[model samples]
Target: MTKYQLFKKLPLFAYVNKIHVRYNPGGPNTETCRKLMLMLLDPKTFTKHPYLTFTYELLSFNERPEVFLTLVPQVPFRFHADTCTLDDIHRAIDADQYKAHCDYLKRRSIESKYVQEE
Candidate 1:
């Protein structure tokens, strides 16, 4: 897919706490990583995820490009950008966010049940 195709709206990052990206600007294969970072920095993305923190590093030309996501429960997920498409990264984050939401709802239900019992 073309790089512009990856600029579409991103899924809600409700469960994500922090995003860290490492990419080499001069590297020919780091286009995906650069595009991903741009998407994260978009105004619409910021509006959708107000509480998220974003940090990025420009690596040397010899280094690999990677993205790291820190979930609400302090879970760390890593993705290699050079070998994956933007869609792949989005799908993985979407799946993890869904799981986190489900886990949150489950915990809340259990807590409410105990409170009702008390």
Candidate 2:
């Protein structure tokens, strides 16, 4: 696949399992956005293989922390402090660890197919 094509390619998991995460540091939607986004993107579903997106609703800006989890499941995903509590974020990461473990098993099983030679 071409680079652009690859970019366009949507992982099956993305469609099968998906969540919308929205967060705003401050303003009218701040409170609701933070809670809702955290719930939706909770890492508990890591094994489920979902494409999660974290969106910033406000234009007023500061450099957001590197959300490694949102981009790379191998690393723990960080929830923005301004928008979420530390405990909440940690719990999600804890849950993700279990799910990631399970995912490893599932992948091994699928890859274990022994193709017989004719």
Candidate 3:
């Protein structure tokens, strides 16, 4: 199942099975964008497969981190900071809500392409 689908099923667990974090110094005053990616697995079936994958761009434009899903390569899927927060993740899964966000981005992406060609 895709990361989105899996996230909808599995209860949120902050314990990451695997993670990678990288920090790049922009300058003395410039805020560095820290990139992070982590994999969450179901405790009961930890050995089976990874459940959720979270990719975040922290300090984006010197602001809050932007969450993303890499369930599908080459597709940029964005999540609202408020909607996909750590608290929400721990509360309940809302695949349909986030799915709508993904759809909106997809449409915007496609529309931009057409506008560029016109």
Candidate 4:
């Protein structure tokens, strides 16, 4: 299946809680994927805060087990590289926030639909 289709099947939380890579770092789609993750994962309530920055770190190959993306939240929270599906991540997140995110996506989707019909 196409990447977009796969992403649609996953929960909104998955976009933030996990890393979604389509190609290597310099590939055209790489930045798009990164931005998408940031948009969904943005910490601000109601809207995303543009002032927040997104960053990534790569450890030397000598480091232990495996390499994964680390999200440095202003506040502490649990994060991991486990291979859980979107539903799993959804269940793990705070209920109210999950609902808010879903609502945000729904509103955005409706807005896009209206734009397309215009």
Model 2 clash pairs are 69-77
> In model 4, what lDDT does residue 101 have?
56
Q: lDDT for model 3, on a 0 to 1 scale?
A: 0.37
RMSD of each: 6.9, 11.3, 13.6, 12.0
Task: Kindly list the per-residue Cα lDDT of model 3 for residues 1-118, writing each as its tens digit.
Answer: 6545553433332222322222223422212122123233225434553543433333444444334433222223344443254445333334543554465576679555434663
Q: Give the range of the ten consecutive residues with the poorest summed lDDT in model 4.
A: 66-75
Candidate with top lDDT is 1
Model 4 lDDT at residue 18: 32
| Off by more than 4 A, model 3 | 1-9, 13-48, 51-61, 70-77, 82-84, 89-118
Report the C-alpha lDDT of model 1 over 37-105, residue by residue, as the tens digit: 778878998788788999999888888899888888787888888988777876777766777777778
- Tell me each candidate's TM-score: 0.72, 0.27, 0.27, 0.28
lDDT of 4 by residue, 20-110 (tens): 3332333332343444455546666225333333435433333322213222232123333223433444455545444545655776795
Judge candidate 4 at residue 109 and give its lDDT. 90
Give Cα distance to truth, residue 34, candidate 2, Å: 13
TM-score rank, highest first?
Answer: 1, 4, 3, 2
